[model samples]
Target chain A: EIARAAAALLRKVKGPVGPLAGRKVLITAGPTHEPIDPVRYIANRSSGKQGYAIAAAAAAAGAEVTLVSGPVSLADPDGVTVVRVESAREMLTAVEAALPADVAIMAAAVADWRMAEDAAQKIKKDGSGKPPTLQFAENPDILATLGHHAALRPRLLVGFAAETQNVLDNAASKLTRKNADWIVANDVSPATGIMGGDRNTVHLVSRDGVEDWPDLAKGEVATRLVERIAFALGARDA
Target chain B: EIARAAAALLRKVKGPVGPLAGRKVLITAGPTHEPIDPVRYIANRSSGKQGYAIAAAAAAAGAEVTLVSGPVSLADPDGVTVVRVESAREMLTAVEAALPADVAIMAAAVADWRMAEDAAQKIKKDGSGKPPTLQFAENPDILATLGHHAALRPRLLVGFAAETQNVLDNAASKLTRKNADWIVANDVSPATGIMGGDRNTVHLVSRDGVEDWPDLAKGEVATRLVERIAFALGARDA
Candidate 1:
């Protein structure tokens, strides 16, 4: 009916994803802020380029994409629903709200620890000899949570492993541990210029083996990933 | 005569300066990344908007401006020289190289500690029993270092205090402790929407006591602050 006509229109518009039309894609991106005070928070080197690129790519392929993003200075991608969040907990909540998707990509650099209890007031430095000790609590493991969930789990679950050394082994281990179908691994060494830079060299680790992806722009990476995803989903249906 | 003519041309182009013309201004902006490993670093909730705004404003006032910035998603301002760095140490070096200015503003949220010695490889968590312990080394205090330097010290030094409570008191304390001439204090409580937000409510604390400033956009604050600086310098030179 109306939905099928709209899907057909989208399929006509996006030739690359004629099969991907009407599919729902969920993505998470950026660095989660762990509030220390109202003013200060702990964050990392996540510019949201990769996740934004993925969201854009999925949308271009005619997927209904919902992007749950942490605080980032990036423009929202066209045709994608964006939910802005501040912390790991909030990001998890947003992800849950955007669930029941066909595919899920967890690419955000989530902080492992946050202040157990955020100080309502900014912590003052006493001219005292010792600095204040910060106590941390473990953040929710978003990938593992969704992967292990009984219901509301996406058909295809993907995670990211931003590693420095032993990249392949670490990524392989994470693929099993997180129960993720695929783990996109990359080295974020300062020398690599991948942390906040546009270029990335990643490997896709799956149950079969690792596929070493060539160095490319983040946007190109997203495009290739989406094409692979479309092919796999089409094969599954066939 | 040639130098004076060039100065006159620049002043004609940027008409805001009453006394900032021909003056050298140095500014530091953004959050310093303290490396934990090749993949991770500690950072704060700093967008560098305020510091960048100050640099742009100073340049608009016909000042020879040098902005030393850490990792931030911002384009370099026209008519301002920008030195980019990743960590606090690098920022300090860049700031030192751009020194001997008429005015210096420290707006970088520098991490207090970095990994004592960064692991060459990413630290892996054993599924065993416990998380790996992290050791940290204190970072150099760039504000105090510059403020105390005999030869490289600027004529007018300013520091900022992003406080949640006792804003004026903390700012005053920081002014004396850091040897800065003025302290710009702000409440960054979540209620204020100031941290990583565009609008700011700041208090200018000087030897003459506190001047409560109204909430305004970061760019507006920069403009007014530059005006005040121009006035002060004009009076001193006169």
Candidate 2:
């Protein structure tokens, strides 16, 4: 009953609030697979929950949201136009297609390196004397590319810095290298279940400074993020 | 087979890399659930992934890791000592207990408010003509408390800021307010997925400046973070 009332109140409040009604938001989610063979590929565990949640929040805030997602099984969020892609290259293409958005959030766990050349067929292991050496090459830095773009660059270009030590120092360096307006940093060791779990704790960094928040649910984070975006755009207009 | 080989190579290369060894590292994770009733409480979705990952990485780097976790189901990482708590108060107690460490990472998403009094029994929904007003009181600022501790303060005190707009500005304010050595910042909007997902993107902020990183797997972030921590500690030692 309380939840229902709160939801009703929210609807009432949102009816008159079009903070981002005409804004276009582009988001990337999940892990891009770097294929080594027809059947096998290198991929990380990224559930796309964060990206999906952001899409929902952006739409709720009245933004026209385009979600460029990697291969994930999650359902498409309401009011969000989702574009699915397989590899980093495909994701980049999709992002390019969704250009001129007001905000571009690069949330996908893009593989930094991919197999130099994908194998036509899967190699069979017959107790080979030596293992095959799979050559790799660095993939495009999507955030940096978009951030440094002369055109089609969103007003706000945000990147993620997942660091373990000197977290601040490394994030600061990245801010300049990527030329991003903002960066979010967190530590993601295996024991924390950050990669596959349902909750997160993070920090926000930018030119102005840093702010630390109490750990909260992803949903809460999404809602708060939307609120902030709305406030930021509104302040700009004012 | 490929994974095993990579692990072997990593082990061989890691032996000569002493970065955080002989360091006493402390970390906090998850959300503190402040109970209003036995079955009801205010809690956030802080799975403690970032903090746990930090602990694991520190341990992997040969540091003595003490993890003070909130209510979470995650098992303790290998070679890590885990201290579990249920509420902000408990979390504070646990953190204090593991103090005088070389570094302290505050990653728990702790609730900022708690019911003044926990109801012994669930509030009956007698369809009371009006909902009962529950009084809330402020919870302790764990980050600030530790960051400003007069004695046994860690050499490095890291805090997280989950913000939406004016991210850098707000983070900067927090750096001063909390007296934190560093702050990790993120939008935490549903789109970014820093919360309960397997992947994350973030920014690092501090007195020196900001650094941003490209989107990568949470594990990759952890590995990179560990490397930074090792380097920073080594530099300090030297």
Candidate 3:
């Protein structure tokens, strides 16, 4: 009995299959839209393929995953609970509702700003030939908010830095600024063909150092990321 | 013989059901992406549904349509030739290639700027945690270029004004600036539900004046616009 107990503890600490069994993971994916109006919105070029892949991998790893997704054309992954939303504000609310998880990954490309004041009616053209000025309001930073939340914060907080330049430095800064344990940074320059593409090259940024990852399919990246998360959390239930 | 000749000319003026038969229409739709690097890009929220609707309507009206589209999830409309592109430069090139048309509609939300300098390799984080500064270069104005083209300019140069305020004024200004014959101005304020929504409210601004149109589905709008184009061209073939 003593040997068996020791072996079980070792399995909990070391890498083990089904390490994330009974673990609750929270993930956000897709592009958060900022409404310019009821029919129009401010959005990004995120296909949500990466985030969706991660959610599926987490589920496959035996985690109960809640994916807070923005509007996209993808079908929901099997064995995961999905909360669909349109705007950044709605995404934030949905994320907050799925809190108190073992891990929280902020992977969605949330719009930075939204129209400060949306017109009530369809704006009409006046006689003058000048353009109207648009005022903007900053959107909520979901990763930062949940990372530094006073309560209901996840045990492990991870964020993503999808940048064109300064991938590592930007991701490292995001780790500190967002109070995240790790950041998965990827370059999205057009030449790389990663944006809206299936393959990605990633760099894992943490306090210790940055680990460069080779280019792989988004699905493979997701599996590796899930493995890392499981190793970090140990074989423990949330 | 004289009466038959007169009727033949009259058929040319009236929409013979397929008024646009053999007429080539060039259109640009969706949001143009501006790449920051190999994997990241700067883009906007444009569903490409409006443009697709226009293409479908144009095809239904017996016009040979070439749609220059950006990255969007929606499938290609039947009977339309779609030329898919990623960045603003690619879109501009594609638009130029599909020229010499009777009507040209610039409907894509082209990105204004792109990273002036893109890193050839994935940037790594040094000891310093500062983010890299990004410089921008302006993208070519597709509407202005085609509208003001010395040659190969479409008989009906139509441009869309997606504005938040001063809808009429901005649209009128766009007509003069872009040298377009007509401007279809629409307000994208959030309450209007015209942005990604199927319905739209438009103001047709021409040299005569602004004609305010009530909210209608994109398909209806397309039908009306095609009718107007047919009337303007007198059933002429390009």
Query: Quick one: best TM-score, which candidate?
Result: 1
In model 1, the runs with Cα more than 4 Å from the true position are A1-17, B1-18
Give the share of true interchain contacts found in each model.
0.51, 0.00, 0.21
The global C-alpha lDDT for each of the candidates, from Candidate 1 onward, is 0.85, 0.74, 0.81
Leading candidate by DockQ: 1
lDDT of 1 by residue, B90-187 (tens): 98899889888999999887766666787787666666434466665667788889889988888899888887677888888889888999988888
lDDT of 3 by residue, A1-238 (tens): 9986886686578633365877899999998766544334455668899999999999878788999999788899998999999888899999999988989989898765666776554333343533344466667789989988998778889899888787788998899988999999998766778877899999999999999999999999999999999988874433
Lowest lDDT 10-mer window, candidate 1 chain A?
Answer: A122-131
i-RMSD of all predictions: 2.6, 26.0, 7.4
Output the worst ten-in-a-row residue range by lDDT, candidate 3 chain B.
Answer: B122-131
CAPRI grade of model 2: incorrect
In angstroms, the error of model 3 at A7 is 27
Worst 10 residues of 3 chain A by lDDT: A122-131
Sorting all predicted structures by lDDT, with the top scorer first, yields: 1, 3, 2
DockQ of every candidate structure: 0.46, 0.01, 0.15
**Residue lDDT tens for model 3, B1-238:** 9986876576578643376877899988887766554434556657788888999999877898999999887899988999999889999999999988989988887775556775564444343533344565666778889878998889888999887677888889889988999999988765677767888899999999989888899889888998899888884533
Candidate 2 structure quality by residue, lDDT tens digits, A1-238? 9986886587577642356787889999887877755434555556678778888888877788999999787899987999999889999889989999888888787766677788764433224333355566667778888988898888877776654356677677778888987776655444556656677677777898876656777777677777777777778778
lDDT of 1 at B102: 93
